[model samples]
Target: MAASQAVQAKLSFLFKAANTQFASCPELSNFYLHQFQKTADHANVPLADAVQRLCCARCGALFVAGINCKVRINSIDASKRRKTPGRCRNRVRITCHACRHPTVTNGSTTTLLKAVASPGLSVSVAPPVDVPTGKKTKKKKLDLQAMLNQKKAPSPSSSSFGLDDFLSSL
Candidate 1:
């Protein structure tokens, strides 16, 4: 999957470069874009999903950190590190210039970097680089027994307006 992801990223870069070089040639740009998509789809790379993290969702425009997109990483909280220590914190945000589409991805920087770096040397065919929705996920079931044992939050004030109250007031 890493190898395929790397291939797709390379193709994206190629098409982006081509698109700029042949700005006047709309057909050439469209050809490059479609060719990229076709190659990625054939490889089963999920390029659009990967590209969604780094490209414009609306226009399928390429994102260059400072050039075409605004790439920024959210601040990480030091206090609640262990309580929720997953991709939920310190998200990577990519805002595209062409369509003004803002994309927020959790902990996807490493995979993107790996894909870009993979083309230089040997392909990283090993697992670990994964798309957001992969097959390894498991359904987390809540422990009802534990929930019952734990003290619940105090109920909201009873004075709060009810549906009947709002309807009557209206």
Candidate 2:
């Protein structure tokens, strides 16, 4: 398959896996979706692809292990987990498996999915899906009459210096 198609297929798998993994864990899903949105907002990937690549494993910290992207998972102890009130259930605290950095979780996966999957979600901002860039056309033919009319138009100083006189002087 072409490079673009391959990238798309990998992204599709990541999104499908994320959907399946997060289906039962809404909180984890929301957290990952939010992280994906934030990362995609800043990263090199197109907004849509960034969103699609966002995934997490049973433990939080945004999974990208099998995906084409370069995200690394940092390990942390489950004992360090914290509890924040008014948050989604099944919330687990952990650090980056790779970097060992600390982060917090908020109940957001469901909201993220709703926002991304929604038909009305800002279609103008998202990139077009599955259109081959190689097939796109550029350059348009100019209108001959329009070009002729522009050529026929007089210069600003033409009226001050009579056209016939100017031509004669030239």
Question: lDDT winner among the candidates?
Answer: 1
Which regions in candidate 1 have their CA more than 4 angstroms from the true location? 1-31, 34-45, 48-52, 76-89, 108-170
Clashing pairs in 1: none
Candidate 2 lDDT tens digits, 1-170? 13355455554554455567664775555454555445434444574433333433223335443332243333333343234333233333334453454434443344565677677664356666865354342211235666777767866765576666679898
Which residue segments of model 2 deviate by more than 4 Å? 1-17, 49-170
Q: For residues 1-170, write the lDDT of model 1, one tens digit per residue.
A: 65455785778686676568544664455456556666666676655455545445555555568766798888657675446545245777888776677888776444455667765677556778655443334321235544655534334666686675689798
Per-model TM values vs. the true structure: 0.37, 0.21
State the C-alpha lDDT per candidate: 0.61, 0.46
Global local distance difference test of model 2: 0.46
Clashes of each: 0, 10
